[model samples]
Target: MAGVAGRLARRWSWSAFRSPVQVTCSQAFPLHVSGTAMMATQADFENAMSQVKLLKKDPGNEVKLKLYALYKQATEGPCNVPKPGVFDFVNKAKWDAWSGLGNVSKETARQNYVDLVSSLRSSESTSQVKPGAESQQGTYETLVVTSDDGITKIVLNRPAKKNAITTKMYHEIILALQAASKDDSALTVLTGNGDYYCSGNDLTNFTDIPPGGVEQKAKDSAVLLRDFVNCFIDFPKPLIAVVNGPAVGISVTLLGLFDIVYATDKATFHTPFTHLGQSPEGCSSYTFPKIMGSAKAAEMLIFGKKITAGEACAQGLVTQVFPDSTFQKEVWTRLKAFSKLPPNALKISKEIIRKNEKEKLHATNAEECQVLQSRWLSDECMNAVMGFLSKKAKL
Candidate 1:
């Protein structure tokens, strides 16, 4: 929410948000465009932001997110929040863009951002940015999104850790999901890169959490979780999930919200909420019972039961399942077929189905955050998480 917080706090100044770029640097600076006029002053640094904002050309999402980060850096200086998860390519990129300016004075970031945009504007051969340089806009360090035709696939790439969801990764997924909703050219498919879909929240995220008292930390963490979960709940397009393997924690609970779920024979789902001595985060407390019935939901959430794909399907939690070896191929074909269906039809149908649940989901989200704040602060959870970490280190 650091990047988001900056975005939401906008004063939307006209000079920055709406201005004409025709005004040359000569007005605010001592010298030339390509020459010694390259020297710029503080006023010019501020003016450059306005000039860049007035560019006639569309710089695309990558450049846009970069500019946003740079503008924030120039105005706000170093990042004050935790780096977002690697899965959230947008915020991660923005964080990197802003974070890289660390040690750079706010005045300097403004000047450098001016220089960067000036160089970009002068390029005529192609509008496309240089490879790797565009990565400044964001990096998918733990996730990847690839598209063929109109079907886009977002993969959780941290297979070595069973695709564990880290703090940064959560932000990336939310950003990607938000992008998917607005992407008319692509319908999204989410799944894992290897053996497991996701193994739940990364323990290291706890370590990386902003330093604060237990209550403050819980508030921050709960707020982050609420935003992430809400992104999934309010997404404005058809969302499909391909469960290639086992999943745990919010990853398992999230399945209740997908429009359709296709799983592999090896796919299983688990939520270790009670086992971890914590409460649920994905609003599964409400969604799970509604989707799979109260009794089955209790068996899974309360007992932390491991649910096999076949069992999940029988309980109506899974839409379909395919052989493990051919899971990707089968799901790909099915999604492509789904892509062939009228996209607007799919969109409208999904909206209609989800419309009724929106308020309840948001209400549940608020309640869950309050409860989670308490759970996270409690001694039971503190001991449980530490015990797990201790054993993981074989200490």
Candidate 2:
């Protein structure tokens, strides 16, 4: 009885002295005070107006509004939260885009997006080379090369910048892969000197790609990288990636084209395309989920999840994960084992495997090139590249 009386008293007081507050979607709210109804102050109206502005700008304002409505209904009597599909209309236009079924009218654009997504999902793992093989060493800018033992080792030498791949480094890699192809080496091992394998393409040259010329430049660059990957893939020997540090974007996806991969405990793998509003590259889509599972691939492609080396190994993306201290020795031992194999036999085996998938690989490469060219000029990619360049300039 006392509680009911208290509630009634408060209600009566509100009705007798408060003005009738009119709430609108805008910043301004009007209130009408009847005779003797002067209890409500200007502060009350201002506070309401501020809340209105917040609701208007909040990304989840609609959701909050629905929740509030549901709360009001429940307090008045009984009600359910608005159905989940209520907001589905807002995303209706983008439904196809998100589902990978983009419109046929925009087929080229859709294909570009699909290809980029695929590249993000691919895994580049190389076949393991046996231990005790001969090795050769080479260096270019921030890259250190160790070849011989039937394997050319290309290591990113920039530990200071986490071994990010620069334009010069990119060209050097093309040269190294070409050399490896001509050599009688049974396998090639690509890794990093210190910690990081290759963080990503250095943003320094991003601004060098001209605005209108971006598409052609992208096509040329993609062709160059594709040729490099093709050389490794078609070589008489296998190619392996020994990752010890963060492999982001292209670095993460390039491994998809390799035959086998070994990573240290400290290695991390991620594709940051979606985060940057850009797409993936390096033929990742076809290879990634095939090496890892489809679900895991989706997680990496969609959310750009950063995966630990152990997680990568468990997902079948990495051939093995070893302690950081023993990783180098173990990798050398494996490479030497490959070097002991008959070079001709290794070449024959590699040729046979590649012959089976040669057509498909070439076709995929062509398709990827087409899409990459289209996306190169996209606003999202352009803006991201520009922003990256600006940030790099500051650093």
Candidate 3:
């Protein structure tokens, strides 16, 4: 039996690189001619048995085949040409390869591999489809939409560039919010499409704004963005955000206006206005400290350290953190639930909350616009912007 097994192993191994039929026929013929049954010692038998056990237990077909081939190639020359059909060795090999026997058959390992492959394939397909899917398809660089039940979702889509607020994008956002306000939609969910929600202003425009005498242009852009933020804050009906990634600058500050905010474990919240040599915008100076304590908000605005989603939840910046995998689904589900509530009740409730703060928000926005306009032309802000661009250019 041992001799037959050894010969079968060698034939299978050689066949892996050659032809299975030829090896099988050749090995069988030699054994018939020898007329003497070759045998193996107890130790040799044990070692060969161990090899079979390993082959049966290996999870991967490629790995098992390689090991089987190697074992055959190593032992075949020294072993005898054994009798045929002694142990059904080929059947065992096939069974092991297909079954993924022993330690490799655990449910957890299989599930892990399945999940890993799913994520890899999803990412690959997304990368291939993403470039052609946006802008060229009339999707626009800074706009996204999703729908669930009767709820409609709008997202700021420039996440790779940190959803930088452009003049056109700002105007479009105001239009979207206004449309949502008028529409009898069940809910409105707003968020960013990628890793960052928004990084504030589009610094690229600064490059074209000539070295001097572009103060009015800068002010115009800042006003447009601030107006959009104000419109979003004052929009009627429920507004929720699934902050699955970073929310920086105006993005973080604007969350104060949202009815609910859900962030992911990987989400980050930051506001770096003071560090950028400019005053805060989106009325963050007042709204941020009001939502989060003055001391905590001051620390973040001054230093600009990225706060984790969990920390944001604790600080009242976000409502909660959903697992990264199901964050969006969970957020939309909540939005749909909110949408099911009585529309008049929701509208009145939201108005009551904002009635007192509306005037305050407007005043703050106007003040912020003035500061931003003045700083936009200041040497400090210009130099900082230019420096940032220079570094970005190198990268």
Off by over 4 Å in 2: 1-139, 210-212, 388-395
Write one digit per residue (lDDT tens) for candidate 3, span 1-395.
67765765565553243322111111000010000111123354334333333222212333334333323322332223343352667655543432322232122222222222222233344445555332232544568755556566778887677788776687667656655665667678777777776676787877766556597687667557555666765677788887867777777888888888888898888777766678777777777799888888888877776789998999898998999998778776777778788887887888787766764675566567777777887899888888888898999
Residue-level lDDT tens digits of model 1 in 1-395: 66653543353332443343212111011111111222347677666666676566644434454456556765666779898997665457557755654564555445445654664454322224453321222457778876566776788989999999987788778656655665664478888988898888888766665556666777778767866776777676678888888988888888877888899999888888887789876778998898889999999989989989999999988999899888889888877877888888887888788776765675577677778778888889888888888899995
Query: Who is ahead in TM-score, 2 or 3?
Result: 3
Top-lDDT candidate index: 1
Tens digits of lDDT, candidate 2, 1-395? 55644543443332221222211110010011111111223444344334333332221222222222222221222222343353354232122222221121222222222222122122111112222221234335656666555667777788888887777777677656655665666777788866678788776655676767766777677656555444444444677888977788788877876777998898999887776656666667667777787899989976899999999889888899889889889878977887788877876776666555553454455555556556666888778777777786899
Clashes of 2: 41
What lDDT score belongs to each candidate, Candidate 1 first? 0.69, 0.56, 0.60
The candidate with the higher TM-score, 1 or 2, is 1
TM-score of each predicted structure versus truth:
0.66, 0.61, 0.62
RMSD of each: 15.3, 25.6, 27.5
Which of 1 and 3 is ahead in lDDT?
1
